[model samples]
Target: MTKLIGALDQGTTSTRFVIFDDTGAIVTFHQIEFEQHYPHPGWVEHDPFELLDSCRLCIEHAVNKLIKLGYQVSDIEGIGITNQRETTIAWDKKTGQPLYPAIVWSDVRTQNTVDQLSKKSPKGVDALRSICGLPLTTYFSAIKLRWLLDHVPAVAQAREHDRLVFSTVDSWLIFHLTGGLENDGVFVTDVTNASRTMLMDIHSLSWSNESIRFFGFEGIELPQIKSSSCIYGHIKQGALTGFAIAGCLGDQQAALVGQKCFETGTAKNTYGTGCFMLFNLGDAIPPVLSHNGLLTTVAYQLGKDQRPVYALEGSVAVGGSSINWLRDNMHLISDHHQLNELAASVEDTGGVYFVTAFGGLFAPYWKVDARGTICGLTQYTTRAHLARATLEAACYQSKAVLDAMNKDSGTPLRALNVDGGMSNSDLCMQIQANLLGDGVLVTRPKMRETTALGSAIAAGLALGVWKDLNDLDKVNKEGETVFRSQLSAESTERLYSGWQKAVTRSLDWAEPVDEKLE
Candidate 1:
């Protein structure tokens, strides 16, 4: 019997299922995009049922194709999951029904709640950072979970009944797919996802009692923290029923593992709806280092025996999302793929800069007051210039994050493993390489579905598809596209300085006005 591993990649905007053979080659795949709801300004949400249904549809669709390709259902040994982190979900323990829409990672609706908690903290806003290695920001899961429990009626009822189960996307999917609450469902989250919640201790790799108490989640039952690469349970239903549900990791960490950044000092930047640049920090808890306000998070843990890997993450709230805004809101381009062409049509942004803080700035600048801004624009500017500026926005943000990572780790990154939607644009990759300057190479894997592949690798490890990390290196040895710096150091530094000025202009532009008087 041939062996294969399945990877379910549940993301912010879409759900994807991919199947990989023993050699790590993608055999087949399917993707389905779901609706993203913005009920209020700065708020984002997704239907939990929609997310779960899409995964099932993708799995059924993809596996049928795999079967048609001569692989039998019995040939598949396990499944792994990689998902968007910090998206909070709460459901009933007995009924397995979601109480509220999944609060997306980028949603800032809980900013007021975050502020209240921060003000009440004895050590101020930085108090949580000491224990969780995360600042008091809306980016973490804890604030969103609190908002749901306090505001949502069903969630409140579940809490009152002591029947609430709070989980990230991975856990919710796992619980439902593995028999739900009725038959010993696996209500667990991997360490990588748990580390992003701000309710888990970074040093101990477990739920922090202080955080749970501080957040007032005493009655809520959180998922058990598990290693990224272990069998959580078996799929009880669906086309791929009876398969072991093995590996699980937050998307960015899965990208890190997929990029094979097994050693410290290695890094990867994922250009998804939001951008994340994760610098692998190995197992060292490096004193809550905050370079430009970068977040410290768990990278992954393969198994129970191995120590968890840590990472310094620089998050940009907008990446491909900015491009979406251009297409959907601004109507500047009819299609997303047209961005590369439109951008390449121009020599530069014509001194224009776009500060894409559509949902406020994250990482290094945690400037919640900032809003999206376009500066240095004049009659001379065209959509082409705007397109170029849009792509440059991502590159500039990446440069800023990279600078912070280098400063914090004291180890300069020599290369970057790039993935996600925007990475497909050669123009964007070239601009990224140019901005970062010499000695920095931007690499894209031949198998661009690396996030799913990373999860598949983890699942494969448990089933003995591959013995260890050493075996993975030989799995997909395809050639990668390398982008080298083409700009002079002087020019790169000057352009980067302009970006700094643009970022400064965007800050403090949209502070929330208080209407209620104390």
Candidate 2:
């Protein structure tokens, strides 16, 4: 049997499993899409048990495919986990029963909590942002943790008894897969994931006492910190018994790591349910931050003296999910793949532009109440026009971020390493380059899921299947698809200016006047 590694990419909307051979190419893959729960208008959640089961199903199905192709399950060498960041989960420490549904990052139900805390503890907020490079928004995990602790009775009860163990998704998976509470199943998170919690110190890369108290919690309630490239725990049982889980990361950080953009000015953009751009900063943290509404974060930490790498991040807040909303809510297309085909059918958007601010604007604009809008629509508009516009909207949002990064960093973008589902579209990459006036490079990964690859890279190195970052880096530098900019200055500027106008028209006009973004 050929040596292979299995990567589990447990994301916001789906769980995907992929096996990569020693030479670094995918031998087989499987994916299982699951349900997203919206219990209330702004409250988003996931069934914890169902989340665990789907991850199992994804791995099992993918392994079965390998078996059918005459590959033994034993051929799998390691497991790496990359998951959605900042979603909070509270569960019984002894029973592994969730005290509440996983509070998804998109859930804005905690807006009041955020605003209340913003006024109640302005100093704490400033300290946290200064140390953590994040704001006291409803989006981070610190406030969400507070929301559950204060509002959910079971959670409050469990916390009082020290029975409620709080964790991000990685901790829950490690707990469940390694025999839950019975086995002392490891409860550790990497620096990348820990950075998003609003609990971690970006400089120290550990749970912060000040922030935890600020969140009204204790550090004892948090997970252990581990290096990104180390054996954090083991899978004590299951289909792949005796296997080690040597890797973990919040999904976006994993994407950045997986892309191998490690130096200053080196960056990556992921086009998943949303679009995110991460710029790597070597050892030093920027004393001053200008977000343009994007977050500045810890890229990763390594070695005995490995200083924390900082990254400036920008999020578009919607990409594939917008296509999903169109199909599910508006019946604009039958499926997501159909969007690619439909978009290619149109020569252009036919004077139409779509600003998919369904959730809100992220990166460059943090208007939480802005709703989606389709502008420049004319009688000539067709489904194909909307489809093209949707795709361009994603690219346009990415460009806006690159522009912002340039402004903040005062350095021009070098080559952008791209990954994620939408990056598969040459049309999207070409459009991205034309507008940004820079080259966009996509990796020819053994698997399309960079999040999982990141996990595997960390895990394998930690487990000694690979020796160190040097060993892993050698593998990642192999082959890449680079899309070069070929657009005239005038045309690109015209399109981008129009996109900005479209975004303006989508702002929270319906929101309370006081809450509106200026």
Best by TM-score: 1
Model 2 Cα shift for residue 244 (angstroms) = 0.8
Q: Model 1 over residues 1-518: C-alpha lDDT tens digits?
A: 55789999999889999998877789999999999998777888999999999999999999999989987888889999999899998889878888888999998877777778988878776878878889888888998888887777789898889999888999999988998777777889999999999899988989999999999999789989999999999999888888998899999999998889999899999998888999988887653457468988889999889888889999999999999898989898998778888899988999999999988998888988889999999999999999999999999999999999999999999999999999999999999999999989999987788899889988988788888998887776677899999999999999999999999999887656331212
Pairs that collide in candidate 1 are 292-364
Worst 10 residues of 1 by lDDT: 509-518
TM-scores of the models, in the order given: 0.97, 0.93
Q: Candidate 2, clashing residue pairs?
A: 25-446, 26-446, 292-364
Off by over 4 Å in 1: 285-288, 511-518
Q: Give model 1's clash tally.
A: 1
Q: lDDT tens digits, residues 1-518, model 2? A: 44688888888999888787755577888988889986655567998888889888887788888899997888888888888898889888767789888998877777667767877664644547877788877678877888887788888888778787878888888778887777777777888888888888877787888877877786236778887766666777667777877777788888887877777888888999898899876677553365465677887765334677788898888888888888998898998789889998987898788888766677778777777899998889999999989999999999888888888888888688888888888787787888877444433343456777777776666666666666665555566677777877888888889998988899865342232111
Q: What is the C-alpha lDDT of each candidate?
A: 0.89, 0.78
